[model samples]
Target: MKIGNVNINGKVALAPMAGVADRAFRELCVRFGAAYVVSEMVSSKGISYASEKTISLLTLSECEKPCAIQIFGNDPPVMAQAARFAVSQNPDIIDINMGCPAPKVNKSGGGAVLMREPKLCGEIVRAIKDAVDIPVTVKIRKGWDDNNINAVLIAKICEDNGADAITIHGRTREQMYRGTADLNIIKEVKNSISIPVIGNGDIKSPEDAKNMICKTGCDMVMVGRAALGNPFIFNEINEYLSYKKKLSAPTIEEKVDIMKQHVNSICKNKGERFGITQARRHIIMYVKGLSNAAKLRDEACKLESLEDFSKFCDNILNSI
Candidate 1:
């Protein structure tokens, strides 16, 4: 799939998950076979003020290119300014977040709240598109609630306002991440717009990815929560789609090795203290279905330093 000048090699892409889709994780997913990856959502207000933490989040390694940087804010001027800053980082695309259902974001008139007011969403898209030379895209949910599911309307607004692509998560803001994602709603959005539509939500396996595309006719599939501990999902789905083959799951040893590599990268980029703390969640996800996963999670949570994390990982691997 092509988003403007950027040509994605495959149709499976990684959703921009905050806290989970950081630089190290994104690079790992890309290496494993995600056609493209998106950075975690950064705050437009924070970036505008040059907040140190937000700047740290914008740090991109050379390996994760052809990646989009997602920014969220209500104000057109502020969002546009943030888009300009994101361009300086040389991301392949600039994505606006109109899908996040978090209360803090919605109360501020950002995220899915923008979906409530399509005109304002269009204005924001226009501003950001004007501010940056890169292709601009919008990520949105079905709508504010079940009573007002307006993804098609919002998608048309995005395309008309110069957005290069649209990503629909197939659920209302009321649903958040709960319940099943409405594939019917995603199909509606795809039929309503001419630009590329990327379908998201509830995709857990290669067959799920194929079903989403076939049922909705979307140009691409974006995996979020399902990719949490399993970046290999990208390669699995890609291989299935390309060759009609099923790949075996990673072994316990392979999982441990990948987890360690992910930690090392995080440590190299963000230092041991912050990286190991952030890595704790991912480690838990990696070992989630194994026997004694609960015990490993409890022990992993107590981890303090890089050495402690390594030992914890080794213990889990040895136990399995």
Candidate 2:
């Protein structure tokens, strides 16, 4: 699949999760066969002010090329400026975030709040597209609420305004990841727009990815929460989509090893202290189904060092 002129090697893409889709995780997923990945959300205001921490979010490795940098802001001029800055960084694509349901973002007229103001949303896209040579896309929710499901409407608005593609997460702000995503909304968006539509929400496995494609006629399927501890979903879904074959889930040994690699990779990139905090979050999820997982998760979250995590992993590997 291609977003504009950018050629994605496969249909599976890792969604731009705010805190979880960092450079370390993206590189890991790309290595595991994800065709595309989006950076975690960067703030337009932060970039306009040259915030060092925010600028760091723009960092992309050579291994994660073809990755999109997603930015969030409601102001057209500020967003345009941020888009220009992001383009200068040379990411594969520049994606605008209109889907974040966070209270702070919405209160600022960004994120899901933009869903209520479709005209402003179109204006933002037009501004970004004009500012950059790369493909510009928008990530949006179904609508503001159950009563105003305007995904089909906004999809056209974006396409008409120069967006190369649109990613639709089929839930309203009110739903907030609570209800099952209405695939029908995704189907409607695909039917309404000529540009490519990527379906997102509740895709937990290869079968779900296939079902989303078959049911919605979307060009791609994006995985968000489902990918936190399981980057292998990309390889599994890609193989299934291409060959109609189901790969076995990673073994317990493989899980611990991958978790270790993830821990080490992040620690190498982001010093020990912060990396271990992030690792604890990721490792707990990676061991979600194992024996004594709850106890281990509680214990893991409190451990403060890389050596402690390595010892924890060793114990798990030795036991199982």
Candidate 3:
């Protein structure tokens, strides 16, 4: 699929998950065959102030090429400026985050809150498009709530204002991450827009990816939480979509090995202390259904060093 001049090589893309889809995980997903990956949402206001931590979030690597840097804010000028700065990161695309359901984000008049003001959404899109030369995309939800189902309207507004592509998560902001995503809404948005539409929400397996495309007629599917500790899902989805082949799930030993690799990369990038702390949740996801998962997860929370993590992995291996 082509989002403007950017060529997305696969049908499955990694979602821009805050605090989870970090550089290490995105590079891992790329290795596993993700067509494209988006960075965690950066604050436009933070970027305007040149916040070091916010700027760091825009950092790009060659391994995760064909990637996008996503930014969020209600202010058009700030968002445009953020897009201009994001270009310096050398990302292949710049994405606007209109789908975040977090209360903090909404309270700040960003994220899903912008859905209530479609005109502002258009303004923000136009502003960023004018500020940057690369393709610009927007990630949005079905709407703010059931009473306000206007994804088609918002999508058209975005397209009319110069968005290159639209990613529609099939749930309303009111629904947050709970409940099933309404695929019908995704289909409706796709039918209403001339730009490529990417579908997201509740895609947990290769079959789910196939079903999303078949039902919604979407250009691609974006995997979010389902990909936690499961980068192999991209490879699985690609194999199933391309060859109709079903690969078996990774074994306990294989999961441990992959998890260690993921952790090692995280440590290498962020330094061991902070990386290991951040990796605790990822470690829990990797061992979710394994035997002694409870004990392993308990130990994972206390992990303070690579040596502690090594011991935890040993226990995980010994359990099976």
Candidate 4:
């Protein structure tokens, strides 16, 4: 699949998850076979002031080619400026965050709140399209609420305004992450749009991924929370999609190695203290379903140095 001139070689891409899908995780996903990845959402307002933290989120590495820098805000001019700043990082695409349900983002007039204003959505897309030369895309939800579902309308508006593709999460802002994702809404958006549509929400297994594509006829699927401790899902997905083979689950040792590699990368990039702090949740995830998982998670939460993590890995390996 292709997003504008960018060639996407696989069918499963990683979603832009805030506070989770940072540089270390994104690169790890790419290495494991995600088709493309989007950065955690950066604020257009933050970019306007050239905030160091916001600018850091736009950083891309060569290994994660075909990655996008996602930005969120309500103002057209500020969004356009943010797009320019993202372009400086040479990302393959610029993704607009129209689907975030965070109270902080929506209360500030961005995220899924934009779904209520179709005209403003169009203006935002058009402004960014005009500001940047690369392909622009939007990630949206079903609507603001059940009674106001209008993903099809917002998708059409985005397409008419020059969005290269549309990614639709199948629940309304009101639903947040609760309940099942409505695949029907994803189908509606796919049917309504001319550009590519990537289906998201509730895809936890390779079978779920296949079901979403077959049921919705979407061009691709995007994995979010499921990929947290399981970047291996991408490789499994690629193998299944390509050859109809169900790859065996990774062994305990393999999972430990990947976890260590991920931890090391984070520590290398962000320094051991901050990286280990950020890696706690991820470390817990990697040990999910394993024997003595509760105890392992408890130790994971207290990890402060790479030395602690190395000893932890040894314990995991020795326990098997």
Q: What's the TM-score of each model vs. the native?
A: 0.99, 0.98, 0.99, 0.99
lDDT by residue for model 1 (82-187), tens: 9999888889999999999999988887899899899999999999988988999999999999899889999999999999999999889999989999999999
Q: Candidate 4 on 102-186: residue-level lDDT in tens? A: 9999999999999999999999999999999999999999999999999999999999999999999998999999988999999
lDDT of each: 0.91, 0.91, 0.94, 0.94
Clashing pairs in 4: none
Root-mean-square deviation per candidate? 0.8, 0.9, 0.8, 0.7
Query: Residue 124 of candidate 3: its Cα lDDT?
Result: 99
Candidate 4 deviant stretches above 4 angstroms? none
Which ranges of candidate 3 are over 4 A from the true structure? none
Model 1 TM-score, 2 decimals: 0.99
User: Which residue pairs collide, candidate 1?
Assistant: none
Per-residue error for 131 in candidate 2, Å, reads 0.3
Write candidate 2's Cα lDDT for 1-320 as tens digits.
78899998789889998777888899989998888899999999999999888988998889997899999999999999999999878898999999999999888778988988889989999999999999999999999898988988888999999999999999998888898998999999999988889999999999999999999999999998888889889999999999999999899999888888898888887889988887787888898989989888998888789889978988888888
Give the alpha carbon lDDT tens digit for every residue of 1-320 in model 3: 89999988999999999998999999999999999999999999999999878987888899998999999999999899999999998999999999999999999999988999999999999999999999999999999999999899999999999999999999999999989999999999999999999999999999999999999999999999999989999999999999999999998888889999999999998899999998998999998887777877888899999999998888777766
Residues forming the 10-long window of minimal summed lDDT in candidate 4: 51-60
Worst 10 residues of 2 by lDDT: 278-287
Better of 1 and 3 by lDDT: 3
